[model samples]
Target: MENHNPPQLGNQLCFPLYVIAKEITGLYRPFLDELDITYPQYLVMMVLWEKDGLTVNQIGEKLYLDSGTLTPLLKRLEAKGILIRKRKKEDERVVEIFLQQSGKDLQQKACQIPAKMQEKLNLSSEDLLELKETVQKILNKIQK
Candidate 1:
């Protein structure tokens, strides 16, 4: 005899992940809107905040984004005066992103976002760390 269990939304792993990602992004929207940056743009800024003067390709690699997607987001941030993309003097073909004064200032304001988001999430520190570690383990396995 053959099993007759049909696939359903409840049985799919992607469904919960999709919903969680959407909800998390939604939770960030108000805070992001205050800074006038979308979630993907925010990810780029966070990377730059940690290490400034990275090339476009470096940022793309870190964020797992393609040039087509990153280019427009970078343009928007550049237009906002948050960053400047300059051609490297030694190799003009290479463009490096440097944070502007505005971008640095924005970092100070953005620092509070994590704590606020945590408060919104309302999970214990222990629980949060465990979840993060578990997700990271899964992500590492997937990446490899």
Candidate 2:
């Protein structure tokens, strides 16, 4: 005989992950609000910050974001003068993103966020390392 029971939140791994993601993004809210960008937009800016002038497709790949989601985010950042999106001269079909002067300046303001967030979480360096490792393991498994 087969027993059937509905799954509960306590037994589901995804529920906790979802809640944690939401809470963490919430934690970023005030900081990001001051920067005048959402978390997703912040991610895009970070990608560009590390490497300026990346093609849209490359940015999408790095962020694991699709064009549909990335395009609007890029457009919003462009509208805010944080970034500039331009079609490649050699290939009009390809768009590249570059950090504007304002965007570059924003990076200076954004650098403090990591320390602030660490203080907010009140997690020791060791604890943070362990948590990062565990999460990366799970993420690797999911990717695999």
What's the TM-score of each model vs. the native? Answer: 0.94, 0.95
lDDT of 1 at 129: 95
Q: Tens-digit lDDT track for model 2 on 1-144?
A: 875998888999899989999999999999999999999999998999999999999999999999988999999999999999999999999999999999999999999998899999999989999999999999899999
RMSD of 1: 1.7
Model 1 per-residue lDDT tens digits across residues 1-144: 986999899989889989988999999999989998999989999999999999999999999998888989999999999999999999998989999999999899899888888899998888889989988898899999
Model 2, residue 84: displacement in angstroms?
0.5
Where is model 2 more than 4 Å wrong at Cα?
1-3
- 10 residues in a row with least lDDT, candidate 2: 1-10
TM-score of 2: 0.95
Clashing pairs for model 1 are: none
